[model samples]
Target: MTPTTGRRPLIGVSTYLEAGTRWGVWELPAALLPAGYPRLVQRAGGIAAMLPPDDPAHAAATVARLDGVVIAGGPDVDPSRYGAERDPRTGPPAEARDAWELALIEAALASGTPLLGICRGMQLLNVALGGTLVQHIDGHARTPGTFGHHTVKPVPGTRYEEAVPEETSVPTYHHQAVDRLGRGLLASAYATDGTVEAVELEDPGAGWVLGVQWHPEMGEDTRVMEALLLSARPAPLSPSGV
Candidate 1:
C-alpha cells in the first residue's frame, strides 16, 4: 500500500477492557467500546481500527500500516507508571490499559506516526515520555472539585488556536494532570485555573503529535479531530519488500 494512492488513512484507537465490574459484579464479563472514538476518526475522514489490549505484537504491526493513531480517552492511568502511589479517591487503577497504551506510544513514536491523545491518553503520553502526573488535582491545581471545567487560552499563533474557534469550551473529566512534562512536549493550552489543557511534541515544525486533556469526541468539538488528521502527512510507500 502507498500513501499517494489517496486511500483513506487507517487510524488506530485504543480500547478500555473492563474485565471486572468495579461497582457491581467484580467477576462480570469483559466489555470493550470505542467510546465515540471511531466517530471522531471518521469525522476526520480516516478508517478506524480498534487497537485492543490483546495481541499487542500484531497491534503494533497494524499500527505500522495506519497513517495515524488516535489514543482514545479511557480509564485513569496507574500513577505508578510515573513513580507515584495510587490515590484511593481516584478509584481503581488500570494496569492493563497503561501497558497497552505505553506499548502503542512506543511503536508510534519509533515509527514517527502522527498521533492524537485525549484525556487519559494524554496522561499516558506524558508518563511514557518520562514526564509525571499530579495524581490528584484537588490539592495540586487548586480546583473547586477534582474535575475542572474552564475556558483555555491557546498560545497565540499556535496550532491550538488555529485548529478551532479562538475560544472554545471542552469537557474536563480527569483528576490527574501533566506535572513534569515529557521530553519533546510543549504545553500548548491551559485552563484559567492554570491546569494544562493540551500539549504538543517539540519539533512539530517537523511533524504533528498532540495530547489534550479533554473529551472532544462527545460533541461540539469536531474541529479537534479535524486539526489532528490535517496534521498527518500522507505516509511513504512500503520500503522495498515489506
Candidate 2:
C-alpha cells in the first residue's frame, strides 16, 4: 500500500541527547537524530518530525497527532528495566531515553499507531512487551564503531517478507538481540547465524508495528519506511452516509 496522494503522512522520529555540546554560541544539551532518518522518510513520501526526550506523561498526547512513529536507534536501554544486570559489553544506559521511548511505545500500542523500531529501539520494544534481551552477542558487529553488512531472511507470509526480499543484505550494528518472543509478537526475520533480525506484531488487526535489528535508514532500501507510511495513511472515506 502507498501513502495517500497529495498529503504526506507525518512521522515522528525519536532523538537522543548529547549530555553536553559546544556549537557556535550555545554550549548545552542538544537533541540529536541522524540525518539519514528524516531523509529516508521524505524519500518514502512522508513528512518527518523529531521527538526529543521529554516528559513521559506527554507521550500519549504527542503520539495522538502523528501519523506514524519511528523509535530511532541509539544508546542501550537500561538493562535494569528488563531485570538484568549490566553486561560488560552493554553500552552505557540512557535512562532518560529509555523512559521516553517506553512511554511512546506504550502510547503507540494503545492507540494502534504504526511504529518502526530500529536497533536499540527494537530491544526496547521487546522489553516493553515483557520479553528479554540477549544482553550481548559477539560477531554481530565487526568493529567498535562501524556497521557491518549481513544477510537476513524474512519469514514467509509475514509482513517483513512482504516488504523485504527473502534474503537481503542490511547494515547492522548491535550487540544486543531479542532473546524471547514478545507478547503478541513473532520473529519475522533472522540472520544466517540464527540471530533474530526482525519482529512483527502477531495480530494482523493491530496497526503496523515492526522492529528490525538492522538500520534500514542507513541503507538504500526504502521499502520498510514505505510500509510505515502506508499504514499511516487514513482509510478511504465511504461515498454515502451510513
Candidate 3:
C-alpha cells in the first residue's frame, strides 16, 4: 500500500550488539531490537531503518539516501575515547557500533541531513567531531538527593528556544556528558546536575541537527521530538489559488 502523494522520510537508526550463550552448550546467539526509536519516529511520520555498525569507509553511500539519521541511546561509550577509565558496571562498547555511527555522522553533516542524538548518541557525536566528554557527572557538579532531572532554559536567540517551550522536564540516565562541544556545535540545553543536556550544530539557514542527553522518545515530553521531526520534513509547496 504505497501512498500517492508523499512518502515517509526514511530515518536510519543505529543498532547495538548484544550476545548471549547457553550455559552448557557452545551456541552463541545474538538479537537486535529497534531500540525503541523507530516507534518514536513513526509517531512523527517517518520510517525507521535499523542499521548495524558497519565500516565507515563503505557506509557513506548507504547513509546518503536517508532523510535523517538518529544515533540512539545505548551502553556507555568506550572510555578510551575520552581519556578516562571505564566503569565496571558499564558494558563494553560495540566497535562496529562506533564505526557505523561515525560514518552516519559524517554523511549527515556532509549532506546537511537532519540529525538527532540521544543519551550515549550525544556523547558519540561529540567525540566523532573532534570534541571531548566529561566521562562522569560527579566530576562536574555536586550531587543532591535527586538524580539528573529538570527542565532547561533554552538560549534566548537560538533555534531551539524558538522550537521548544520556555521550560520542560526530561528523564535523564547518563553519567557521561559533553565537556568540550564539537566544532560547529553549540550548547542548546543543560541539566540540573550542570551537565550538558543538549547540543546542536547551529546554522541560521539549514536543516535540523540537534542532540539531547535525555531520552524524549521514552519519556513524557513529545514536543521536543515533534519539533525535530517536523523541522526535517520538506516544506510543502504553496497551493495555487483557483
**Steric collisions counted per model:** 0, 0, 0
lDDT of 3 by residue, 160-241 (tens): 7767757677666666778888888888876655667778876656568788887777665556656666656543435652
lDDT of each: 0.75, 0.89, 0.72
Model 3 residue 111 CA deviation in Å: 1.1
**Cα lDDT for residue 100, candidate 3:** 79
Candidate 3 displacement at residue 152 in angstroms: 2.8
| Residue 50, candidate 1: C-alpha displacement in angstroms | 1.1
lDDT-best of 2 and 3:
2
Candidate 1 vs candidate 2: the lDDT winner is 2
lDDT of 1 by residue, 1-242 (tens): 12234556777788877766554546674646555788777876767887777655665686678778878877767777888887776657777777878888888888888888998888889998999988777633325434435677787755666776476676667778899999888888888788888888767564667888887876656777777666666554475522
Candidate 1: stretches off by over 4 Å: 1-5, 20-28, 139-149, 234-242
Ranking 1 against 3 by lDDT, winner: 1
Task: Tell me the tens digit of each residue's lDDT in model 2 across 72-153.
Answer: 9988888898888989888888888999999999999999999999988888899999989998888886677788999999
State the TM-score for model 3. 0.81
Please give the lDDT score at residue 77 for candidate 2.
80
Angstrom error of the Cα, residue 41, model 1: value is 1.5
True-structure RMSD for candidate 3: 5.7
Ranking by lDDT: 2, 1, 3
Candidate 3: regions farther than 4 A off:
1-5, 21-31, 83-91, 139-148, 233-242
